[model samples]
Target: MGFFDRNIFIDIIEWLPENDDLIVYKYDRHDNEIKNGAQLIVRESQVAVIIEQGQFADVFYPGTHTLSTENIPLLSDLRGWKHGFDSPFVTEVYYINTKFITDLGWGTPNEIMLRDADFGIVRISAYGSYHVKVNDPVTFLKEVSGVEDAFTTEMLDEKLMPFVLSNFTDTLGEAKVPALDLAMKYKEIGDECEVLLQTKFDQFGIEIANFIVENISLPESVQEAIDQRASMGAIGNMNTYQQYQMGNAMGNVGEGNSEGGSVNSTINDAMQMGMNMGMASNMINQMMGMQRNAQAPQNQQAPPPVPSGPGAPPPVPGAAPSQLSFHISSNGSQYGPYTLDQLKQYVAEGRVNKDTMVWREGMPAWAPMGTHTETASLFGGMATPPPPPPPM
Candidate 1:
């Protein structure tokens, strides 16, 4: 057609993507009319649509189509003008890209909240890419690429990104996967999100081909806490670790023995910690023994212990009295396992009180030292008789 021609008569109609990203393109037909017998070329990975006054007339797949009554029944039925053989028709055509669009990215623009078991509520962010393709040309044109000359993946991303993030956050939160375990569940989460997001995109005739979860990032504070937790191990064997610490400190103490101040200080500090651990372990064991007694089965057979008389049961053979060594609690620090003689000195100095907490071997639990038969005599002088009040 020449510039002088007022009306251009077109014979063939088709479209080659302007770029790889082009998803939908409108066939530009500036005042051009297609003769009734014009050919419509639809290529592979593309779908051609015919529109009459904003209404979908017909859709064509990969083939050469003649715009006639027999080939396009939808448009022919709408127009119903078969009287003239050389008549021209004015209509709009759109071509949709059906090829998979890969590497289209998506990410959470802001941190989303997730409830975690170990760390309670945690804030997290994630990013990944997706792939998609046009599933239905007619619906895509109406819902997504409406009234646009061309639609690219960049434009689609603007709409798809939010949908992806919405579904992704919902999926992750609903799964309630712990923040620490999120790394291991990335693939499972991605697969689920793809399925969920595809359902939402189906309305716009976009199919999600693939979704990926590259990395889910925890907050800096959470990461630091995790590092510290790893550094301070959930120590499995306290006994072994305590032994290692004591051994190492003793080696150091021996090396510094000539330096009197440093040597004594190291010995005191190391020995105090060792004593504290030992007493704490004993206290816990005592509490556990009481718990076992309380929970003992009621129907179980048991004989009451004999009182101290002729009927008393004999002590087990080869057993001897355990050494009387006591631990005193003062100012929240446990002091030495003082022998009976040393404890008498502590009582004389007014440092040990009748109500002070103390524990020793063969005791069921820690208690006021005066409550014990062995230690009651230590506080004998502090008790007074009430004979004068009774006479009154």
Candidate 2:
């Protein structure tokens, strides 16, 4: 078309599959008519090449583009047509920037914190050219700030840091100690923090993945006291010095009596002394009895006299008898041949004397032959004969 033509038709041509093309529609401000077979030229924005043809053909590279027209039938309706570039859909990501961790008295930032501390403090920078694309552009424009600007790290620190610190401090304070000990408690505490941060971040559509406690400080004095008490308590019992001394003393006493001494000899002496005293008492009693018998009344004779016979001696007078004989019935049998000296021995032995029974040859029954002679009197119906005068 000529520059001043009014009846010139400018068609906006678009190619299939690759729309990166441009066709400029130039119109005449003053009224003018174009002749048949008028030639026109077209050019694109990116390339500097020019085209000459009867009908303008818009050729494009292998990409998307926009086309416009001034006077063609369907093309004129696309006068203000612009290219529609579909951007990646970006969901609103709410995170806390923990670059101010030192100022907030928290630990380092890590993936665990990023995933787990969704509503809690997190230190991060824009990653992988991540830009916000609004699904609800109207809501994005109206509700969210910085729509014109990118979501920067500084924005996170300025807007979210205070809320993160406040929430984190409150969470840490309210965090319960695990039911288990250190090794197990660390995992449990991390899990609990993750759950807590996830719940807090639910309003912003964030999910927590992990959490951690970097450092724990306990008082040195408390730890030392605990160690000392444990050490002392481990000693359950102790030995005493006095017990050792007592054991040593007992050992000496046991060792000193290795051989027996004069104890046996002393016991033998005491037994012999007792025997001698007993014998002397018996002899004195016998002598006293002989003297009393010698002085008895004639009508109360002490005993029958022994008649002198072959190889036998008559009784002695006023002298202790040399021999005495008696019999006793025991166990349904007659059982004695005791002599006067034998009687004295028996009396010393605490066996027999006044209680002895005698059976003379002419007597019908046994009689107690003694100074008190009731047996003789009961048997013979006569007084006991006086002892034959002691042998001279």
Summing lDDT over every window of 10 consecutive residues in candidate 2, give the lowest-scoring window: 125-134
Q: CA lDDT of each candidate?
A: 0.71, 0.33
Relative to the true structure, candidate 1 reaches a TM of 0.63
lDDT for each residue of candidate 2 in 1-392, tens digit (9 for 90 to 100): 65534344222222121221111112331223222222332222221111222222233332333332321223222322222322111112111111112221233243212321211233221111111111222222233332332333344335443444444445544553321133345555555655665555444423334355544333354344345444434522212222222222222211222343342343344345545544643553453231222321233223334323353333334443333334443222343333345444434443333334554333344445443343333223455565697778
RMSD of 1: 12.6
Q: Residue 239, candidate 2: how far off, in angstroms?
A: 8.0
Tell me how far candidate 2 lies from the true structure as C-alpha RMSD in angstroms.
38.5
**Candidate 2 overall Cα lDDT vs. reference?**
0.33
Residue pairs clashing in model 1 are none
Q: What is the TM-score of each candidate against the true structure?
A: 0.63, 0.25
